[model samples]
Target: MEKNNRVIHHPILGDLKFRSLINFKFNEKVYSGFEGETIAAALLASGVRTLRCQEETGTPRGIYCNIGHCYECRVQVDGVLGVRACLTPIKEGMAVRSGEKLPAPFKKEGDA
Candidate 1:
């Protein structure tokens, strides 16, 4: 974690060691994360909460279901939309950004 101490050393999980360090961008800001970790995990470890926006109201949203079952962690990757952060692995020099104009869950699917 960047000077903020976002990543914690877990007693059970042990020290989260990484094989290599990867540099990525979030909202155009440079960030560092460990390779082989999920984008959502990396971001969370670095203290990023909001991952996307609710298109209807423009409200900020973030990770909900860590697994792929829910798409709540949707983010834009390299200018592509609808990339799920929780499922997407972080790569060196990857560009990630909160989903701009991403519609609210129900609204996007026309749910009642």
Candidate 2:
């Protein structure tokens, strides 16, 4: 069995195909996703619903509008913060972290 089977196949539009799979990390856990797909789409396809939590209320949040309108899917990508998963495209070796607050900056090799 292959991944990305969750992509809907339209009768008129034909089969929806994704690009080559790329490796990404979420909270240090590795996951595979296709190129050009939004981070939220990849996460949902992988069964990850909880994208992050409210900063003040600490309530769980996930993909709501799936567009840039909703900020529910905010996640930390690489060392940056407040990146919208629904609008951000997945890239190879991207590190994504979801939490109530922004994650600490990632340290590179030989960093003090």
Candidate 3:
């Protein structure tokens, strides 16, 4: 409760009622966020900045280019990998976790 990262009082989007607060699991921990918000938004509100790590280096990566262009906020949802948290809506009881960096879906010609 001490560390609230949510911008509850913004000049433009002022005073959201937050009537439909929903609960979901992130990294085996329970977190509550407003319904209808994207998973990325919810996680941000919950003070979770590091969504995932670099594929090879394992450096922390959070929400960048929140419009879904960067793909830096990709996370696993309900056991599915490579889900764009910025685009995916947070569902009640959904299990969200930091995704493991996997190889690209398609391999290059020389790749085995």
Stretches of candidate 2 exceeding 4 Å from the true structure: 1-5, 102-112
Output the worst ten-in-a-row residue range by lDDT, candidate 3.
Answer: 99-108
Ranking by TM-score: 3, 1, 2
The residue-by-residue lDDT of candidate 3 on 16-95, one tens digit each, is 56759788998999888787899998888778889988876678888999998989888989998889999999889999
**Model 2 TM-score, 2 decimals:** 0.81
lDDT of 1 by residue, 5-100 (tens): 444578799776666878899999887777788898888878888998877888888999899887878889998899999999999889998987
Preferred candidate (lDDT higher): 1 or 2: 2
With candidate 3 superimposed using the best TM-score fit, by how many Å does residue 50's alpha carbon deviate from the native?
Answer: 0.7
| Model 3 CA deviation exceeding 4 Å by range | 104-112
Name the better of 1 and 3 by TM-score: 3
* Candidate 3 steric clashes: 0
Question: 1-112 in candidate 2: lDDT tens per residue?
Answer: 3245365688898888767988899989888888898889888888889988877557889999987997778899997788999999999999999966544346567878
Q: Highest TM-score: which candidate?
A: 3
Q: What C-alpha lDDT does candidate 1 achieve relative to the native structure?
A: 0.83
Q: How big is the positional error of residue 94 in model 2, measured in Å on the Cα after superposition? A: 0.2
